[model samples]
Target: MKQALLILGFVLFTLPAFAAAPEKSGKSKAHGNRYQAGFTLESPEEEAEPPEDNGRGVEIPTLVVPVFEDGRLLNYVFVSVRLQVADGVDPWKVRGRTHYVRDAMIRAAHKQSLGADGNGRALDREKAAKVWMATANETLGGESITGIHFLTVDSRS
Candidate 1:
């Protein structure tokens, strides 16, 4: 009977501690109330603005160059290039001089011997981009071009 009374007293004392609701503190109320009220904690001035869209740049047509090995044609390399222009440069100006650019690119490709060589070594893309940039800059009358990106380079034997 004494043990039963002791157990009942322990249950009665501990039940209130577990059942009581938590007190809403000031810090938690400030943070949670703002979110609940649909207001963001971070101010709009703290957010970064997106960059401006200048243009899509220019895309050159695909180029085909034949590979030679010891006086015989071995394979052909097909390359598509995109010339990325800097901001404020007009894409129409580059488009207007497409013929000269194409000619310059063809000459550059031929000079570089693009594609597999007689020793079966493949052309380097970095070297090709550098050459293309140089050629395009020379043809376009200035260094308005930011980069020369190779969209596709496929070789067939």
Candidate 2:
């Protein structure tokens, strides 16, 4: 019984000392179900930068059209453009041409023209909380759109 008691006392005192030793370099074991101690490595910032692209393209303008509660683009409005083709051109061909233009406009407005998806396409409530809409204006013979006129349609927000 004396020998057993001595062995028990030795184990009780030595357990804490053993636990204080430094852990091995690689690999870590989580304690219990909660996270306590471990090494986490993130990729270096220099290596995180995206590779460069060499594609050249035409640039389009972004128009911020506000939606007005009453004759104003303050409450709620979409950032978009209404393109009307030049005169003598058939409306059908104009429609076809404007489709690509509108597509480019949407891409530019959403800032998705770059390699990665831009904030415009993101549903994030912070950065690009503003909405966008595309509408093609009808041309009157040679009549043309003098300039982008941001008009308010409806206001609910």
Best by TM-score: 1
TM-score of model number 2: 0.24
Q: Report the C-alpha displacement of residue 39, candidate 2, in angstroms.
A: 48
lDDT of each: 0.68, 0.35
Best-matching candidate per lDDT: 1
Q: What is the lDDT of residue 49 in candidate 2?
A: 30
Off by over 4 Å in 2: 1-81, 112-146, 151-157
Model 2, position 142: C-alpha lDDT score: 35
Alpha-carbon TM-score of each model against the true structure: 0.57, 0.24
Per-residue CA lDDT of candidate 2, range 79-154, in tens? 3233333444454555445545555444443442211124222122212212222222332223332223222112
- Superposing every Cα of model 2 onto the true structure, what RMSD results? 21.5
